[model samples]
Target: MKRFSALGAMLALAGAAPLAGAAPQPPSCARPEWPQEARRYELEGVTTLNFRMGPDGRAIEPTVARSSRWAMLDQAAIASLSTCVFPAETVQRVQGKLLPLQFVWKLQGPDRVPPALVEGSCAASERFDRYVPFDKGVSGDDGVLVRLLVRGDGTPYGVKAEAGGADPALAQAAVEYVQSCRFAYPKAGASPGSPVSGRVLLKQ
Candidate 1:
């Protein structure tokens, strides 16, 4: 079985008020577990999350300050960091401040990590933009789910898409969008012409 884990969080002061006295101890944070979906795709990246400390020492209003390229990894970072707890003294030192925490997702072992979707590709492509207007204005938070086969060379093919409880027309648009995009896998680790199944969630 493949193993995936996140590195220890790197913390930085984001507009945190200067301490007049001694610096407080660092907060206890539970790093996020790598998403299985990302693991299956061999995705890796660093996601930065920002949050304030609540009176009870738990993270408050945790939000992704910067995406890890993949939504799955970003969501995983937010969900896990929300459970972080600052010491009472640390909370006061950083009260009402948005602290930045960086979580890095890295695959363990010798196998090379597979390619991930290029940043700002696929659903964010110009092709997707052209199709969106003609999608009959079908828009919702419930994005379309698309499954497709990607060649070892990173070419996407045979997209099978489905709408998430919306009009089926969205599926057709998602198919075209997915096929137009590219993946970034190395030929050394991937077999040429070998087809692999890939999934993506397309949202407006």
Candidate 2:
């Protein structure tokens, strides 16, 4: 009873230096917002971003270090900072440091209506069958709900593991399979769908 689908991945040009990998420290608590259009259509995903701490201790040139496949989501994340206060002392310690964050889009509702890019639920390629190669014995569960961020053009921008949990191997496989997928929303039109929370039941 599971239906696995494919998603899209966008390639962005290298702009500024990549953000520092050092774990996030204190005072870096700026949360991103969900795009209005994306929320209307129920599109969700994670936009991993990076911004440079200019010499003046203010944020500058925030860019999409990693795309969520949804242009709207990415743009929303970049515009999150209006007053970035950087401590010159801290910047000195981390001379060439860039900030990195993963802005997420998760919906809260009881509706299971799948998000679409056009006028209806998205249409996916018939490639799910061959995506995951796991043994039924260790797959852990027969089914799991996968939350996805579907872009307006029908590309699944992001995929997430839902429920309390699932077999480690199975969950990893499911995510990888979905990430490598490609889909289309014939009538829904191009818009972001945050949580295309679809139930995926494994094949016997």
Candidate 3:
């Protein structure tokens, strides 16, 4: 899966960053499903949408300022971001806001977009606003793959190392770092059905 990206519409400066106060921006962790028809024919394009969010973390207008020229692609892009959960109050301090984002739909020639390319801003542990990996200058750099269990409200719990035999200290550090992170889930309220896990690559 090759990386493809384009600038989406920019929000007008009228509102500025909300004064609501310190909520970490939730990162995108999934991709909207590609239209089967589009995938069958190997259609690919980038859709740019201007989405509005309320203080309650719901999406308002999901208009495509820039079309992918493919209606199915555009709709997929809008629907996913429009309905997904976000940290409460969106921008922390801002009470209400408009967020414009661009979603690129590139077929992998394998039926689905790869998961690694799903979260645009999330980089393993870096996606969490609070999971800071330990850095030991020369002590030895080690890494662990952990499945971070994210609850409906975006709180990360059960940071289980997916593999065995990782250094105990390094693994423990990853768990602790993840425990410190928090997330906000939208309409689903406090629990988002079942536990959703995201894998994090931790290095120390």
| Leading candidate by TM-score | 1
lDDT of 1 by residue, 115-152 (tens): 45555555565324422211222133444545554676
After superposition on all CA atoms, how large is the RMSD of candidate 1? Answer: 8.3
Each candidate's root-mean-square deviation in Å?
Answer: 8.3, 13.4, 19.1
What candidate 1 gets wrong by more than 4 Å, as runs, is: 1-3, 6-24, 110-174, 177-204
Candidate 2 overall Cα lDDT vs. reference?
0.51
Q: What is the Cα-based lDDT of residue 141 in candidate 2? A: 53
Query: 2-33, model 2: which lDDT tens digit per residue?
Result: 12111222222134233332213333434455
Model 3 residue pairs with clashes? 18-94, 20-93, 20-94, 21-93, 23-92, 152-192, 154-183
Cα distance off (Å), candidate 3, residue 83: 2.5
Order the candidates by TM-score, highest first. 1, 2, 3
**Which pairs clash inside model 1?**
none
In angstroms, give how far residue 60 of model 3 lies from its true place: 0.7
> Tens-digit lDDT track for model 3 on 181-200?
56554442233322322333
Off by over 4 Å in 3: 1-23, 27-30, 89-95, 109-204
